[model samples]
Target: MSTSGSKDMSRRHVLGALAALPTLPILPVLFGASVARADDAPPPLPSWNDGPTKQAILDFIHATTDPSSKDFVPAEERIATFDQDGTLWVEQPIYTQIIYCLARVPVLAKANPHLAKVEPFRTVLTGDFEKIAKLSLRDFETIAVATLTGMDVEAFAAEVKAWIAEARDHRWKKLYTELTYQPMQEVLAFFRANGFKTFIVTGGGQDFVRVYSQRVYGIPPEQVVGSALGTKFGYDKAGRPFLTKEPKLLLNDDNAGKPEGIHLEIGRRPHAAFGNSTGDRQMLEYAKAGDGARLSMIVLHDDASREYAYGPARGLPDTRVGRFPQELDDEAKKGGWFIISMKDDWKRIFAFE
Candidate 1:
């Protein structure tokens, strides 16, 4: 039989088996929402379809984690790095961090007063969202520094916490943290359940993500690594010590910087890596370079009905934020990394769905 015909036959066999199984009571396995189970524990990646993408993860996990498997890796050596933004949750239209920055600009302008007259700041202050949305990444970075820094670390954290608590995604009317992808959350939990140490390596600010990483993703602040600005050691007026957020670039934890950040912060190469954009290409490459049973996956944003779709990868809409360019898609295919189609592989995207 030809290869394509054989694969079709195999798929039919799998589907036939699935259709034969009785629908039984399932032990609850939801991301943040759960009900009591009656008998059997539910399968991992319930939000994921029973396809090659899900099968690859299952195969990798069993091979590396089973004691009798030849590919079994030592517990301490099982490190998985994940890129944030589109990989975990939503990064369409604009990044959630950038949204936070946009919200902060007016508040900061109110406090500082003089900043209201600045170009991007002036544009932001006008409340014309069309113009604000068109602001460049560099412009947003400047606005982020202006709003998120200058204050002491604690104050910066407190403000972020406050905003995160109250801020909702404009489209969904849910908290931004609540917008995390349910399938990805299951992946994180499954990796941890199998002795893998999961770390978030993002292009976002380190200190900013740290404030809510624990509550949002269940990853501790220490395990989060991201692009970082500098801080100054000093004392407050009460003779207490504090670290002020300074205007200095420390690490740019995206693309090529991701591998460097992993080396510096993790002290070892990851066994598995997951990402969603061109910015994460190098991290995926670094993970694939590791010896023995490595896996790299990219979450392709190709579903528009359930969520926003913008991937120049498979002729989807081109987007500035979290771009999945055609070349990057080609590299993933050539490099033997899995491209997870959001439209097909994911049964559901967000938990709310």
Candidate 2:
């Protein structure tokens, strides 16, 4: 048979076969295009394997941000505070700031042999980790002040800039400037996207952190608040206005002092707060107690594979040493806080080379 006659025979056979079977209701066919559209839809953010903790955070944020919601917070009150050291960057092994101070000891010792003989500086010069770790907070502060003294504010800023440019984190094999958490960077962006103004509240020297914070963390100099040495407003030999460093007014932005620093610098309570250690417990509490919807988050340094792990170290016997890990656990059990496990929550640590 010709091709058309053969096709006609095949159709007749198919019709005869269907006719032999029992009659059934017709069903609608779904097109590939429509099926694809349904399958390609993005999953809801808080539902995508984030667990209960992350879901609660997303729900809280959504509740506060939705204008029609009863829990909506005004944009003007959306201040977010962040603790710097272990919160945004690495503080394990040794703090980056302490490394900077220790680096200055050799130079300072050359000019003043008395520093070479001092407990902390002596420990630092001879690379005695045990002794360095044992120095009292008062002794450490004395060394910090001595190293920071004499230079004018502008000169001190320049020195910090230069030091940052050259200093590398011993564990990361990258400059201290490059040790910022990639995940936290995304969180900062997320806050900005959510109409929150951010500030870095830290225990490190404010002037030191402010030197590069804006470029590194997107926070402006005026928004960076931390421990500060006393400054003297003065004029140079040519009568130009200048600010000089003095050996007084040490505002240590650690432990209980964090709340005081926040009150002094931002002048308003924050609606959201992020931090990484027990040093930040009070700041988180202060943020959580604000009049409106608030979020308090702690970045737990649990990712040993990606970053170094540390608990609070026992400091030297004499000074007011800040509390560490056990306190962190207490804060966690206190509840109403978001605990972010770095290993579980972050896909990456620092920015890639």
Candidate 3:
């Protein structure tokens, strides 16, 4: 069969399997409205209004956490995983890692000189986005290797930290860290408060995500599982050992790799999982496939005005960076996975004004 034919068949198989899973019924609990303190202050998931989507989470937690409930899960067993790129932060226009690579080119070219005339670097330097956007996956991986490798882990992490600190989103003009969804922040905290351990499973480099995962999302470095390049253990003249980043890929925590990452790193099935794009389908499936009560949700980027909208849905552009295929939505609907529509569900998108 042709490559495209094989992919279409694979997608159909996945969608069929997902459609077979039973959708959990929405529980009749007004948990969101009832969580106000004596001072009439907002609840933990304040950004989530009293709606079916928010109530579903409340019900899931209540059922799984209450000792008398049949669905009661032990605290240690309550694991929750999230996708970082489009799910936790803005990933439109280009991936933040790609942006970082583009920014590093000039400095790298200044040192290497020859890299200034290279295909990817030369195009990136000229700011020809159309050319950059047309680059194949192999081309992106080439850029990743050039900019991300050769340094010790600590040095690479420091560079990533510095870049993250200064990098601003082109649309909002705020720092990228400032562009996290307010509702998702609440969701992270809410899950933690409910005895669920939250983790970020992303397609971005583990080393890069580790630099700011704790500060940005309140998730520790140990809780992050992501794509990685190979590393080499070496010692200096003083005999201090360090791990140097190698250009070759060790793992890619995306698509089917997500569930593999969760299993390999966390060593347990998640009680809940959240993501926004088709890359997250396998992770969501892994979460929902757990023995007991599970909550798997997808964040629908429907609010084009507040944030960029691109999906294989009505009137939405077909985006390559963070594409949300229509089949994923169909599977979500079929499988009873909650779809968190940014337009309908989130009261706020960014923490910034």
- TM-score of every model? 0.88, 0.78, 0.87
Runs of candidate 2 exceeding 4 Å displacement: 1-49, 110-122, 311-327
Q: Which ten residues in a row have the lowest lDDT in candidate 2?
A: 313-322
> Number of clashes in every candidate structure?
0, 1, 0
Off by over 4 Å in 1: 1-39, 136-138
Worst 10 residues of 3 by lDDT: 30-39
* Best-to-worst TM-score order: 1, 3, 2
- Evaluated with lDDT, which candidate comes out highest? 1
Taking the tens digit of each residue's C-alpha lDDT, what string does model 2 give over 290-353? 7656788887666567875445422312212223465565666575787777767766777872
As a whole number from 0 to 100, the lDDT of residue 90 in candidate 3 is 91
RMSD (CA, Å), candidate 2 to true, equals 13.2
Q: Clashes in model 3: which pairs?
A: none
Candidate achieving higher TM-score, 2 or 3: 3
User: What are the per-residue Cα lDDT tens digits for candidate 1 across 210-285?
Assistant: 9999998989999999998889999878999999988888899998999999998999999899999999999999
**Global lDDT of each candidate:** 0.85, 0.73, 0.83
Candidate 1 to truth, TM: 0.88
Q: Report how far off residue 323 is in candidate 1 (Å).
A: 1.2
The local distance difference test score of model 3 is 0.83
